[model samples]
Structures are given as C-alpha cells and as structure tokens.
Target: MPDIDDFLRNQERIITTRGWAVTHVLPTDDDPDTTAPFAYTVGLTAHDHPELIIAGLPPLVAHTLLNDLARQVYDKAERFSHGQRISDLIAGYDAVIIDGRPTDDLLPGAAIARYGRLRIRLQQIVWPDQQGRFPWDSGYNFDPHIQPMIAHL
Candidate 1:
C-alpha cells in the first residue's frame, strides 16, 4: 500500500498537471477545530477560495481520497462546461429557524448523500474529458517500453 503522504503528493501532482491549483492543510492535534489529519482545499487560485474541500478521516483509505478528489474535479468540469459560475456553485443556503430552533440538519445530510453517490459512480466509471481522453491519461502514450510489457504480460 502506498503511504498516505505519497498518495496525497501524487494527487497534488495530477491536479496541478491538469491546470488546477491545490492548497493542502495539515493541522496539528493541538488545534481544537481539527476534523482530520489532512485536509485539502482545491481551486484555481492561490487564495482561500476553494472549489472543493476534502477532509481525511483517520480510517479513510487512499482510494477513497483519490475518488473524492476526482469526483469533485469531474463535477467542477461539468459545471464549468455548462457555464455555471463558481460563486453559484459554492453558495450556501441561509439557515432558517422554525420555532426558534435550527432546522439545518437535513442540509449536511443531503450533501453527504450526494458525495457518497458521486464516489460510488467515480469508482465504477472512467470519466472522459471533452477530447474523449480519461482524466488520468495525459492524452499520449510517450513511454516506448510500456506497450511491450503489456504484450508480454
């Protein structure tokens, strides 16, 4: 199995190579608001604005992390293709109170449900870009030795 650090580094490489910027945050145990050991906020800018924020739980495996990242990127690309604004995508609903109590429990649960579905779909499908190339592929087979190994194997 790959080390978590190595896996995250590879993710960063892939995202950057695809023309998006990634911001990684590693919080210490001393922090009171720490949700996970590692968290990433990815976007196209160097600032705090992020298109996706992923938190890695203690039991979260590498594949899950990768799938979540990939799903978010795919969703972002799809929305962009449809001319959706980033601000519209990231906009949050104002919390409403009924009988002087918050009724926002369903909001978080809905987001989680959406994410769960996305991750499952990501695992089952190889999402292709506008050019019909898989996101993980560089659109070229530059390595001369890989084909020979594939034929032999």
Candidate 2:
C-alpha cells in the first residue's frame, strides 16, 4: 500500500526479463499487530502453478526464500500441495504447504496488478516455531498473530 507503483513497475521489469518476479511486503496498517509480515511471487500461476506465500519472516528473508522456492516451481517444475512437509526450505524446522486465500489486504498490490485483480490462489509455506511446533500444535509458544492460520484449499 505504500506507493507500490514503483515496486510493481520494478517487478514487471524483472518478470519480463527473467520470466518471474518475487515481491516482499512489510507489515502495514492493514496488517494488525497479530498478523505477520509476508512475501509472495507473481509468476508461478502462469506456469500452471499456484503462487507461493510465506508469513512471519522479515522482508529480506522471505524474499530470499521465495526466490529459491519460485525457482523450484518454475525452473524445476516442482509443485507444492496441501499437507506436504518440506524440510529443505528452512533450517532445522520443517515447513508445511497449505492453501491460502488471496485477500486484498493480505496480498500486495504487485500480485493484484500482475494478475489483473483476479482471485489468485496461494500456497503458504508454513514454518514451525523454534520448538518445532506448528501453529495448530499444542503448546505452540510463538505468537498466534505472527502467522495467520491458513483456511485450507
């Protein structure tokens, strides 16, 4: 929401030249204290794949992770589906892939602009807390708002 025209323009150039683009979004007014910062991709859907989304990470961290994941999806044709646990994405703790909704406030303007405001489906790369406990796990110590719960596909 913070004058993302420049961001979108930059992303458009990246996608046009490199065949894909990754965008990181910091926490904004629309994102309350309970919601964590998130990052997303804008090109996988065009390859018959769902765009990737990750929460509870800093902009740079999420951007780096999304680039690796996007490469897997785009270059290697790797596809992430619901309930799949992936250990290679993050160190120590594993991540689960789950369905995510494309709410206007949660996803950035870059995504909306890239896909013409359509309801873009998202697949969340849900990482676990330090104790290896996911949000739905009992005794999870991390703040619930740090990662919004996925509604499932």
Candidate 3:
C-alpha cells in the first residue's frame, strides 16, 4: 500500500503539470496578485476527505477538472484499500468536497452572465452489516441548476 504522503505528492505533481496552480492557503484579502487563470485550494477535512476549492475557470472546465482530480484520488485509495474495494476506501474518509465557483462571483453583488456555479458532494456508499459486500457503488451528485453546464469531456 502506498503511503498518504506519496499519494499527495503525486497529486500535487499532477496538478502542477496540468497547469493548475495549487495553493495550501487562500489568497489574502489584501493581496492583489490575481494573475493566475486557474487556482485550486486543497486541504484535508477533519475526517481526512479532501476538500477542494476551484476558481477562475469556466464552469465546464472546473467540473471536468474536479471529476478528474477526484478520480485520481479514488484510484490511489483503491490501491491502498484492503481487498481493493472502493467501499472500503471511501469508508476511510469523509465526503469529498468539490466547490467550484466563478471568479467574478467573488466580487460583491457581481452578476455572472455565463456559467453557473456548482458544489458537488461525493459521499461514500454504505451497506448493512449482514449484507455488506465488496464492489460498493459510489457516485457524485451536483446541483440540478448546473445541468446545462455538463457536457462530454
């Protein structure tokens, strides 16, 4: 099984190589260096699930990237989970949070003319103790309002 540190290091490398700026800290309120086209703030939740905040990209791009990143993490967890069960991997952490909002929306009362925002929650699948089995089903659900933004990626 791979260590969490190695997994996270690979994740950071992937994000950087894909041209996304990964930051442990959010930009300070007083700082005025908003030149990056895309930014992702990533941190672990209290229960160990990854919480990701993505900004500056269009809604579709953000959604695609979110899915890609989550898949990457899930893949890593699958390798570490006993019996290669996705359910076991998910059971080890909290819900994965992907919060994607338009950069312009950060402005007070700013009206976004295009691309709706999305906050997706991916929860782990659970089973009854007696009926529990491997190959657990898991998926993500997004706000219905963002349906128009989803397309083949």
Candidate 4:
C-alpha cells in the first residue's frame, strides 16, 4: 500500500493540474466498522464546494462516478442540495444526494488530512439498485450492509 505522504503528494499534484482528485477506499477484513468500500473527491473544497462522495460500489465504479460528477459540478458550477434528486447518473434510476456528515468514519482520510477532520463537508451521491429501489426502499436487491446510509445512520 502507498504511504500517506505519497498519497498526499498525488492528490496535490492532481488537484494542482486538474482541480480535483478521486480517492477510492476499500475496507480491510479486520476493520470492524468499515463494511463497505467508498470513493470521494479530494479537491472540490478549493472551489468552495464540498467534496463529493459515493459508497457501496466497486472501486472503479465509485471512482468513475466521483470523477464524472465532480467534473460536471466544477465545469458547470452546479451545486447539489440535500434531498435533491439527480437523474442523469444512472440511465433510469434516480439518485439522491444526502448531506454526509463529516465524521471520521464517513469522510476520506485524504480529504480530512487536507481539510482537517470535521472541517470538510461531503455530499453523498446515493444510487439506487437495478430495480430503481433505494436503500431505504423495500425489496432493494443488495445486502443491507453493502450500502450503509451514513447520513441517516
């Protein structure tokens, strides 16, 4: 695994050249609290926008989502409000933007290290299942532990 300093340098370089960087994290088996994997953007804070995050997807999927959404948000200067419904991400399923609390467990360490723990803000882009069922909805396909709605938890 890469060291923290290396990670910081990479984020800095990308943020410097591209205005943002994506950080994808997967939990180890020993980590009791982190049951699901997640990804987040690292440099949105520079634009005065809170960092964007998405959990419960594969690393590459999460990375792509973060990158695409971050680009749109930055290029278009679009800001998502809590409880707002977004439809463009998934073909037919609408995603919800939840106000992710900047807690230690929810926010990425890279973002926290750059912006300080509890100082940064995150908006989690929560996607629904294939059936267009959200985590909060009944008959959702994924296992309950796959998508932990940290905002509501």
Question: Largest lDDT belongs to which candidate?
Answer: 4
Clashing pairs in 3: none
CA displacement after TM-score superposition, residue 6 of candidate 2 (Å): 2.9
Error in Å for residue 34 of model 4: 4.3
Best first by TM-score, ranked: 4, 2, 1, 3
Task: Estimate, for each residue in 114-133, the C-alpha lDDT of model 3 and write its tens digit.
Answer: 11123322222211222242
How many pairs of residues collide in each model? 0, 0, 0, 0
Task: List RMSD in Å for every model shown.
Answer: 18.4, 2.8, 15.5, 2.2
Per-candidate TM-scores read: 0.26, 0.85, 0.23, 0.88
**lDDT by residue for model 4 over 88-114, one digit each (tens)?**
887777889987766544657788888
Q: Write the number of the candidate with greater TM-score, choosing between 1 and 4.
A: 4
How would the candidate models be sorted by lDDT, starting from the highest? 4, 2, 3, 1
lDDT of 2 by residue, 1-153 (tens): 647678767877888876678777675687566456888888776777788888888888888888888888888998888889999988887988987667643665566676755657788888888899888888988877777755542
The residue-level lDDT of candidate 4 at 85 comes to 90
| lDDT (Cα, tens digit) per residue for candidate 1, span 1-153 | 888678557756765665333333444568644333332233322221123322233324323543454455554643212112232221241111011110121111222232332221111111223344322347723332111110110
Residue 143: error of model 3 in Å? Answer: 28
Most TM-score-accurate candidate? 4
